[model samples]
Target: MRLTILALDDVFDTGLTVLLDTFSTANELAAAQGNPVAPFDVRVVGLGRQVRTALGFAAPVEPVDAVRKADWVVVPALNAKLPHLLLKALERTDVIEAVGYLRAWHAAGIGVAGACIGTFLLAEAGLLNGLEATTTWALAPLFRQRYPDVRLDDTRMIAACGQVVTAGAAMGHLDLALWLMRQKSPELAAFVARFMLIDKRPSQARYIVPDYLAHADPLIERFERWARSHLADGFSLQEAAKALSVTPRTLQRRAEAVLGKSPLAFFQDLRIERVQHLISLGEDLERIAGQVGYADSATLRNLLKRRLGRGVRELRAELQ
Candidate 1:
């Protein structure tokens, strides 16, 4: 099945450029991996044959009707500064007529997506009224104020299930596309992520943590980094507090506020994750135990059996 992508060039050339680059790179990687997925056929479509960008560049555009038969229609980010003329142009009857074509395709089961402020177009078209969606973190407050009924999660980089999907920011557009590719064709997704030099197995937790820490104080960020680096050292809360020049109680309170867990619990979780990674890498139980700061192999085995419901050999077998 060929994937026809209707790339919306919303008068922001730089944003559109980034979107195209990422998508094309992902497609090429998928192809090179011997994955049996159809290559993406991307077309730049705008209000007219000639579209001018915010940076004062004019590029040839396919007519808006070009998207009528697309398998997926995507809207890239627009400039944050809403140009009065641009907004007025987009509101014209002809543009509305063009958008109706997109609406019809969506109603027929075609996939639709928006990244960053592009989500506003979908919202305007009444596609996101009650859905859980997200946009760029900086625009989240305004989005909530404007669309009170829509549940917006600024922490997520991407959210999708079937026909409709939304991404939080422009940078996450790559992640969104790769995720879709993976769902439709896992080989392609793995290929593309590797080609892009991205870790293919990033945790959903990683995406949420950054947004949660977006407005944190510098001290908190510094302490979190310190904790991450010391995960294998089995640093106690009191030891950590002493290193950061704070009392253990104060550290515990701050950690709970920022990480939603007591300092000791967070440390233990981090240590367990590290042990799992090392074990997956084929480290011996005894070596893994000492490396991850456990007292001995027996202690590590007991901890793994209790927490993960498996012994070292069982975990290794699962990995294989």
Candidate 2:
């Protein structure tokens, strides 16, 4: 397979390197297996001769114009982790040019993939419009605000739709690379995963910090506080709106606008967050259930399993 890695300036060092290393490993593994599978022909191409990484080192790359013959293109995340910094980086001239290149590439029917903040670039290029995509969970609110047309589901570790693929967070780079390898050879993808000690992580829900997401909106922040204090009480949207001095409709609208979820859904998120914390503290499951406003441990357990994709035992083991 012919693959091009888009190396933008200030790109995440690990994100770029992980792709290089994973594909390189796959080639080595495939060769060792004495299989007739064709190895990936990978190229790191940038708009300029060299691009500085986030950690202040230079990587030499081929000119972007040379990538026309590639079958697939992958974009690694930029170093911008915060919302403001990411927004600023998106406006840079080089990134804008790269977005144009991405649009042209996708238009020509080349498969496209992006990891972490790089997904933002794909969305910026209008490739992710009307497609299912995921990004770094922490900045999901900003992503929703910026690209309302795209179906952004930040809870997923990786989301693939049509020929476009997107992965979550920084280390999701590895997942994206493995997914690409799987498309070529699932056996080789499994071998690479075993070699790298990569575990199956289907969701980012467990890692999300609810308060950080809440702080993205003033009303959400206040509502988060109220929710935490009233965890024992049943969720009531009207009550929450009254507490925040806003109408129920306004509260619901703002929550959907900022968090891409209903107020009731976010309330469940807050409950789950507290449940995880209490589980780590060795709290009994039944008590924990009541604390989170669930009437029974079975109900809470099912909800936890549904939302977090893990059982209580697994969650506690992970916390340990």
Candidate 3:
């Protein structure tokens, strides 16, 4: 496979290095295995003659036009204190040119992927419209505001819809690369993950701070406060609406508009988060269930499984 890894000014150092290293390692392993086919051929392309990393280092790169030869164009995440800030900064001529390259490649039927904030650039170029994609969790609000037409899921580590693939968080670059490797050779991808000590990250929801996400809007913030207060007692959307001095319909509308979910769904999300926290503190399953106001441990167990794709044991093992 031939990959064109797009390097941008102030690109994330770790995302770029890890992506290159993954393909390089796969190539080495393929050669060692005496596979008849090569694993990958990678080319680094930049808008300008030179590119700088977020770590204050520079590297030379091929021109934007070089992407035409690639089977896949990989856009690594940007390095920014706040990824939303990076999105605003991306209106520069160099970044816009790179977005155009991505748009052109997509129009020509080539596969395109963006990890973390790189997904924003893809959205900026209008490639993600009508496609399911994922981006960094912290920037989900801004992503939704900017690209309301795109089906954006900030929770999933990887979301591949047709030729447009996206991955969440900063290190999701690895997840995206491994997924591509699996498409080529599932067995080899497993081996590469084991050798590199890369465990599966099913969803980015575990890394989300519910408080921060709620603070984006006043109604959501009020709901967050009500949910937290009622976690031990139980949730009542009707009562919550009364407390917030709004009609139930108004509350439901705001929750749906701001969070893209019903009040009940948001309530369950908070319940699951509390369960995760209690488990992290070494609380036993039964005790956690009682504390989180669940009548039985099985209900909480199933909720964890359904939401995170991991059972209690797997989640606890990760923490330990």
Candidate 4:
């Protein structure tokens, strides 16, 4: 399938550069894979033939008419001084025009995606109101404050529900593009990952960590870090307690009080995360089993199957 992406050249130079580079790289990778299907076709659209950036530079832009023909519309973040009269005036007409195009495309069964502060435009256009979205971590508070109706999840690199997809700050744009590629062509996604030297797969979860333990807990945090560093060596709870200068019973009690789980349970979760990470990186199941403290590959297979509903090979295949 040929995907046409209309990238909005907002008043931000750095953000626009990143968006263009990432989109181009992803498209080139997909094309190089030699798939019979045509890869992505991207165009930059804005208010007129040219738009000035915050840094006093001008980026030539395609007319807004291009958006009407796009399969997907992408709005990069606008870094111009906001809450000002100029911004409000621009949003009243030009910004609204771009957003209206996105809404109309959505009505026509086309997809719309936004990166970082661009989500504000999606929200303003009513495409993201009452939808689960994500943006940069630094701006998440401001986003929630301004648009209380939108559910903002900052933990994920990208969050999408329905037709609107929002990505987080910086490199998360690449993750979002990769996800779109994966949906369009799984084989192309694998080829792109190889071309880009990226080994990890996209995660579907909104919050990898549980909500109850969101607050800072120094002991659990320390233990979790220690477990990750020592995953290859395999440490026992007794050893962990000794490292923390506490008795095993005392450590277990404190862990339960703070994290609402026993020490061993938390350790098991960390082990599972490590094992999954290793498996996603293309580690052999037998080697992963030994590295994560399992007696054999069979035991590790059972554990992974019970926890993730998939064995090692299946998980690896899905990621690759």
Q: Specify the highest-lDDT model's number.
A: 2
Lowest summed lDDT window (length 10), candidate 1: 201-210
Rank order (by lDDT, best first): 2, 3, 4, 1
Task: Determine which window of 10 residues in candidate 4 has minimal summed lDDT.
Answer: 206-215
How much is the lDDT of residue 225 in candidate 4? 72
Instruction: After superposing candidate 2 on the true structure, give the runs of residues whose Cα lies further than 4 Å from its correct spot.
Output: 36-38
lDDT of 4 at 273: 78
| Model 1 agreement with the true structure over 79-175: per-residue lDDT tens digits | 5543344356457574466467567767877788877667766666667778888776655545665676777666567777467788776565666
- Alpha-carbon deviation at 19 in model 3, angstroms: 0.7
In order of appearance, the predictions have TM-scores of 0.56, 0.97, 0.91, 0.56
Q: Which of the numbered candidates is closest to the native, going by highest TM-score?
A: 2
- Output the worst ten-in-a-row residue range by lDDT, candidate 2: 30-39
Instruction: Give the range of the ten consecutive residues with the poorest summed lDDT in model 3.
Output: 80-89
lDDT of 3 at 8: 89
Please write out the lDDT profile of model 4 over residues 142-237, one tens digit for every residue: 466567777776656788896789987645666777777777778776777777776452432322443224223566667777766676676688
State the lDDT of candidate 2 residue by residue for 1-320, as single tens digits: 89999998899999999999999999988888896765799999999899999999999999987789988899999999999999999999999999999999999999889999999999999999998999999999999999999999998999999889999998999989988998888988999999989998888887888899999989999999999899999899999999999999999999998888999999999899899999999999999998989889999989988998789999899887
